[model samples]
Target: MTKKNKKDIFSSKNLNKNPSEKNTYNIDHVLDSVFGKEGTKKRELNRKKAMVLFRAEDLINERKESGLTQQEIADKLGKDKTYISKIENGKVTPSVDLFYRYVQAIGKRVEIV
Candidate 1:
């Protein structure tokens, strides 16, 4: 029934750190701690990978909403079910053209904002 400050919500409470210590934790801090600093190679790579995973999840939801199965999408794209599965699982990154094909195959369209 009380509001927690952002630091209190994101601090190292699970790590057994002293609650009295000043906590500067936020999303950026957590990302830097887990994936290295922004602009570093590790962080940059992780950022790209994260984007790919997000897009994959979006495609998955869109396909489900459209009432299409992975095999059906694969049929539309002339690919095997495993290929679509790989993309959804983040084991594959489709090219821009292929990504657009995926969106269209699921009865969706891409719009630039």
Candidate 2:
């Protein structure tokens, strides 16, 4: 067997470069192509929607992990089950304060930096 050169193995040319630089579809490129560029109204709107959906999914996962149901969380928050359902379904985006309450209700804590 031949001796291996660590430098050669760790060379920049041997490293995985960014996919967009290789003319591949990175998420930014795909989003820009499909939803217009960042700062544009369409892209901004979509970005906000995506963030809400992500938070909604995270809340759902957290609730499930805490072994709690929507009704339980709703009870903790003194809200209706449908309210939690709406938030988790991404049909509603709660304000920051409400979102913090939801997180707390799910037995998770978020510290604002």
Candidate 3:
């Protein structure tokens, strides 16, 4: 038999379903399709959200583990209570140095691996 054309190959029974439309709940795959393989504005926004959530959660957990309140953390960092609130609420993105300071205030050190 002759080799199928590229269109014919892609037009196979299953290839018609787009990756985003497929029912796979895998986050990476969904993100790849939605944001593109590299990244898009929408994807970058979503990435920011995810990063904020992660950082907030990390901060919250560290504070809890160290038995410190937001006020206490702010005191340690010489910041206002609202500053801590904003960080924990994902309403702010801290600079790298500020993040290090915040994490240190909670009695933890940042590790790069």
Candidate 4:
């Protein structure tokens, strides 16, 4: 795997491009060029990782909507506030146990599909 396949969700060119520019490349072309062609192992893994990050973002939003402070969640989970902060800020990935506790902290439950 190339270094890019490991970390980039989009090429730097795409990220740095001006939104007001007249033209942009097709998303499929950009993704394929950055990660790999569709069905490649790296592409699949990158997509899954992207989904995880998206879910982590959703978790942060949901927690905020629940009106619970990070400190309060940390207290409920018997962890330090930094633990919650780390997870919500995308600095750490929550373990399954932590994920459940997070959902439970805000009066929600995880339903595996």
Give candidate 2 regions above 4 Å deviation. Answer: 1-30
Whole-structure CA lDDT of model 2: 0.80
For candidate 4, which ten residues in a row score worst on lDDT?
9-18
Q: What is the lDDT of residue 97 in candidate 2?
A: 84
- TM-scores of the models, in the order given: 0.72, 0.68, 0.63, 0.67
Q: Report the C-alpha lDDT of model 3 over 1-113, residue by residue, as the tens digit.
A: 13454344434452444567665333444346545564577778878888889979978888999999999988888889998899898998878888899888878898899
Screening candidate 3 with a backbone cut-off below 3 angstroms (N, C-alpha, C), the clashing residue pairs are: none
Stretches > 4 Å off in candidate 1: 1-29
lDDT value, candidate 4, whole model: 0.81
RMSD of each: 7.9, 11.6, 10.8, 6.6
Pairing residues by index, what is the TM-score of model 3? 0.63
User: Model 3 has how many clashing residue pairs?
Assistant: 0
Q: In order, what lDDT does every prediction score?
A: 0.82, 0.80, 0.76, 0.81
Q: Candidate 4, which segments miss by more than 4 Å at Cα?
A: 1-26
Score candidate 3 by lDDT. Answer: 0.76
Q: Considering summed lDDT, which 10 consecutive residues are worst modelled in model 3? A: 1-10
